[model samples]
Target chain A: EPEVTQTPSHQVTQMGQEVILRCVPISNHLYFYWYRQILGQKVEFLVSFYNNEISEKSEIFDDQFSVERPDGSNFTLKIRSTKLEDSAMYFCASSEAQLEAFFGQGTRLTVV
Target chain B: AQSVAQPEDQVNVAEGNPLTVKCTYSVSGNPYLFWYVQYPNRGLQFLLKYITGDNLVKGSYGFEAEFNKSQTSFHLKKPSALVSDSALYFCAVRDMQRGNKLVFGAGTILRVKS
Candidate 1:
């Protein structure tokens, strides 16, 4: 079955440095999303993208965070300046519609 | 706001026994509920979803859930458990009246012992 794919299974970055997480959603999917899970915490929604623009975002998705559909197949999340609290597992998901979404393996971001 | 609650933080069941993971939801308008399973070091895998129609929704891996409007609950059930079933399970809800973002519960860890 087709699945969303994320690159760099693990990443470690210095505090105040920038990091980019990449994802390639299923070819036919129309809606994309980003969610994060801190260790021993609930999965928190970050942002949702549709039509090449942000459709909605949560408080956790502040100015430091940005998402882009750089191409037809690539969706990327960029953190301008990483904070220690930014350390978590970031998941990429896509849905043909709003009903159900398929998720990628996730990128583990570690900021020291 | 829409939210989901997985009452039990963890549930333990023996192999070959039936298992149920409790999930209750709060939402305005109609509710779209879903269940996802996460194995160790893996992403959330879609198990099933309840949009409309039958209250009992069957999903992948011999799992099913019953949607109760009056109770406002959607509980995941499996007739017989297997050791492999041990994992973290999450219940989520989407508010149709609001937007497309999904609100997830804290998650329940299911431990099916052999």
Candidate 2:
């Protein structure tokens, strides 16, 4: 089966540095989403993108964060500046209209 | 708002015994419920979902869930358990009225021992 793919399975970055997490959603999917899970916490929604614009975002998705579908296939999440609390497992998901979303293995971001 | 509750933090069962992971949800409109399993160090795997269907929905790996509209529950079950089934299970719900984001439960750890 086709799967969502994320690059850099794990990342370690300095506290103030910028970080970009890359994901390639299933080729035919139209809706794309980003979610994060702090260790031992529930997964939290970050943002959803469709048609090259953000459809909706949670309060947790603040000014410092942005998402881009730079090309047809690659979706990227960029954090302007990282904070310690930003460390978590970030997941990328995609789906066709009104179906279950498939997830990627996730990018584990670690900030020090 | 839309929310999902997985009441148990963890459930332990012996091999060959039936296993259940309970899930209850609240949504203003009809719900789109889903169950996902996470093996250690891996991504969430789709288990099953309840859309507009019969109450009983069968999914991957010999697992099934019964959606109770009156009680607002969608619980995962397997007639018999296996050690390989041990993993973290999450219940999630999508309220189309609220946009397309999913709200996930805290997750329940299922441990099936030999």
Q: TM-score of chain B, per candidate?
A: 0.97, 0.97
Write one digit per residue (lDDT tens) for candidate 2, span A52-74: 89988999999999999998999
RMSD of each: 1.0, 0.9
lDDT of each: 0.93, 0.92
- Give model 2's DockQ, 2 decimals: 0.73
- What is the lDDT, from 0 to 100, of the residue A38 in candidate 1? 89
Candidate 1 lDDT tens digits, A1-112: 8999998899999999999999999999898999999884699999988898988898999999999998699999999999999999999999876579899999999999
| Fnat of candidates, each listed | 0.72, 0.60
Per-prediction DockQ comes to 0.76, 0.73
Write down the TM-score of every candidate.
0.97, 0.98
